[model samples]
Target: MATFDARQMQSLTGLQATARTFLMVGFTVVETVALGLWLALVQGAPVISRPAAIGLGVLTVGLVVEHVLTDATVNGLSFSFPLARIVGISVSEALLWAVWLGIADRLGGVDGILVAGAVLSVLLVPQHSVEDNILRGEAPLSNVVNLNTIGFSLVEGIGATVWLLLVFEGQQFAGLLATLGFGGVDPAAVGLAALGIFLLVEHDIGVTLARQG
Candidate 1:
C-alpha cells in the first residue's frame, strides 16, 4: 500500500509544478471565455446591463487600487507573463460577474440574482478550503476543514450579495446618496461602488485572519 505524504504534495517541483501551473492558467482562460460566449451567443443574453457594466467597471478599478495600496498580487503562476496574468484575471473577474448576473436576470430578476448569489456563496466554501490550504503550504485537505474559514467566506459572500441588492434596490440608500449631492447617479452604479468598498474591506479582513492562523 502506498502511503500518502502531505509534504510531497506541497513540494511539487520542476516539470510537475510547471505543468500544474499551466493547467490552472488554461483552465481559467477557458472558463472565462466559455462563460462569456455562452451567455452572449448561446443564451442571447445581453452579456451585461448598463448598470452592471458600470458596477463591474467600478469593482475592477477598485480591485486594482486595492492591490496597489496593499502591495498584493493575484495568487498564481506569473513568473513569465505577469502582465498577461493580471489582465486575464481582471477580464475573468468581470466576465464572471456578468455571467452570474445574466443568469440571475433570466431566472427572475431580483429574486434570481439573490438565488444565484446564494449558490455562488456556497460554492466558494469548498474552493476556498482547497485554495487557502494550498496557498498556506498545507495539504489541500489538511485541518479536516476549518469552520472559521467557512464562516468568514459565508459572511463575506452573503454580505456582498445583500449589499449589492440594497444598492440597486434600496431607495433609502439612494436617498442618502442624493442628500449627499450625488443623487443624479444611477442607483446600480452607486450600489456597485459601495460593493467595491465592501469587497476591499472583506478581503483585508480575510487576509488578516489567514495570516493570524
Candidate 2:
C-alpha cells in the first residue's frame, strides 16, 4: 500500500469534497424553493400554480435524496479533520435555517422571521453547548452521542416540532391552547419550551464550564 502525503491526500479527496459542496448548494436551493412554495400555498398566496406545486413536490423529493446522499457520502469517505466534519454540519444546519426562514418570510414576513429566529435560537442552545465542548476538546468526539447529546436531540426535536406545528397550522391548534386565550401564533410557547430544554441540559456543560473558570 502506498502512503499519501498531505498534498496527495488533499488532491485525492478534492473531487469528493467538491461534489459534497455542490450537493449542499443544490440541496439548499431546492429546500428554499420547495419550502417557499409550500408555505405560499399554506398561506393561500395564490402564487403557486398546479405545475409549480408538482415541481415543488419533485424538488422536495430531491431534498430527501440529497440528505441521504450527503450522509452516505460523508460516512463513506474517511475525513481527516474532526473540525471539518463539525463545520460541515454547522454549515448545513445554517443553510437549513436559511431555507426555513425563507419559507417563514413567504408565510408571514418580518413577524415570521422574528419568530423563527427566536425558536431556532432557543432550540439550538443545549446542542450548541455540547458541540462547543466537543469542538474545544473538552469532550471526546468519538463519544459524540452521550447522555448530553441524546438529551439535546430529544429536546431539540420536540421543540422544533412544536414550533413547526405552530407556524404551519397555528389556526388549527388555537383550540387546544384556548385556555391560554392566545388564538394566533404564540412565540411564548416556543420560548418556554426552549428555556425548559436549555435548563434540562445546562448541567451537561454549563456547570462544567462555570466550574472551570
Candidate 3:
C-alpha cells in the first residue's frame, strides 16, 4: 500500500475541506435562487403574492445572516443596538412576562410550567422586537412578516433535522458523524442565504425604484 506522509495527509485533508466549503456555499446560493425563481414563476401573476415573496426573501436573509454570522456575530450586534432596541426590549420583555403569567396554569404545574417557560424564553421575545426595529417601510407589516418567516424557516429546518434523526440511520451516517464530530459549521449556507436575502431585497427595492423612474 502506498503510504502518505504527515504533510501528504494534511494536504489531502485540506483538499477535502476546501471541496466541502465550495460545495456548501454553492448549495446555499443555488437553493436561494431556485426558490426565488420558483416563487416568481408560480406566483408572478398575482399582485397579492408579491408581499409573500418579499417576506420569504427576508426570511432567507435572516437565515443567511444567522447562519453565516453565527452566534458570535449576533451577540456582538447587541453593542450597537442600544438606541434601536430599547423599545423592543422593554415592550417585548413586558409582553413576554405577561404571556408567561397568563399561560402558567394552562402550561400545567411542574413539567408543563417548564415547557411554557421554555416557549417564552426560546421563541416569544426577541423576534417581534427585532422586526419592529427594522420595519422602516410604508408597508407597516413587512418587518413583522420578515421576522416571523425567519422564525418559521429556522423551526422548519430544525424540525426536519430532528425528524430525520428520529429515523434509523440518520445519526449513523458517516458524513453526518464527521461534520458533527468535528463541530464543523455550515458557513457556506449562511453566505448563500445572506446573498439570497440581499438579492431578494434588492429586487424589491429595484422594482419600486423602476416604478418611480
Candidate 4:
C-alpha cells in the first residue's frame, strides 16, 4: 500500500483544486460557444466556421458534467466556519458567470453575447433554485443558506449588467466591440432585452417555488 505524507497530501489537494478550476474554465467556454452557435443557427445565420461548429458540438456534453460537478463540490465542502461556505459558493457562481461573459464576448458581438448569456442564465436559474431549496431543507435555520443563494444571485445579475454596459456603451472599455461583430442594430436595446429576459425567468422560478412550498 502507498501512503502520502502531510506535504504530499497537501500538494495532491492543490493539484486537484487546480485541475477543477481548469475544468470549470474549459467547460464554461464550451457552454458559451455551444450557446452562441445554437442562437446563430436559430437566427438562420451561417456564422460559425466549420471547425468551430465541430468543436462546439463535442464540447456540448461537458455542460451538464460541469454544472453537476460545481453543485457537488460546493455542497461537499466541510467548512467549519459558516462564512467559508457562503463565500466559497458565492465566489464559485460569480466566477462561473464571469467565464461565460468572457467567452460569449469572444464568440459573438456584445448583443449576441448578451442574448446567449441570458439564455444560459435562464436555463441554470432553476437548477440553482432547486439547490437552494435542498439546502434550506437540510438546515432550515441556517441563515448562510439564504445568504449564499441571494448573494450569488445578486452577483450574477450585477456582473452581467456591468458587462453589458461595458461592451455596448462604448468600445473604449474593452475596445473589441468592432472585432466581435457588435454593430448592427441598437446594442442598448439588445442589452435591455437580455436584462428583461433574465429577470423574468428568475421571477418565474421564484413564483413557482413559492407555490410549491
Candidate with the greatest TM-score versus the true structure: 1
Worst 10 residues of 3 by lDDT: 68-77
What is the C-alpha lDDT profile of model 3 across 122-147, one tens digit per residue? 54324432433332222323344333
- Evaluate residue 138 in candidate 1 and report its C-alpha lDDT on the 0 to 100 scale: 61
In model 3, the runs with Cα more than 4 Å from the true position are 1-4, 44-213
Task: State which candidate has the highest lDDT.
Answer: 1
Candidate 4 weakest lDDT stretch, 10 residues: 38-47
lDDT by residue (tens digit), candidate 2, 1-213: 245587788887897667655644554444444444444443443334674455445544544543343333334334333544454444444444445445565657445655664565554554455454544445534444345444444444344445556655566567766756565547445434443343334323332342242
How far does residue 14 in candidate 2 sit from its true spot (Å)?
Answer: 1.9
**Could you tell me which residue pairs clash in candidate 4?**
none
**Candidate 4 positional error at 53, Å:** 17
Query: Model 1 misses residue 80 by how many Å?
Result: 12
Candidate 3: lDDT of 161?
A: 29
Sorted on lDDT, best first, the list reads 1, 2, 4, 3
lDDT of 4 by residue, 69-111 (tens): 3433334333332443434344444345435555565566656
How far residue 167's Cα lies from its native spot in candidate 1, in Å, is: 7.8
**Ranked candidates (TM-score, high to low):** 1, 4, 2, 3
Question: Over 4 Å off in model 4, which ranges?
Answer: 1-4, 43-62, 69-127, 132-145, 162-213
- What is the TM-score of each predicted model, taking all chains together? 0.49, 0.35, 0.25, 0.39
Which lDDT tens digits does candidate 1 get at residues 1-213? 134565556566455546544443443333333333333332333445564555556545543333322222224343332333344344545555555565566685567768867766665565445445544546656753566566655664665465556544566567777887768987655554555444544554555554454
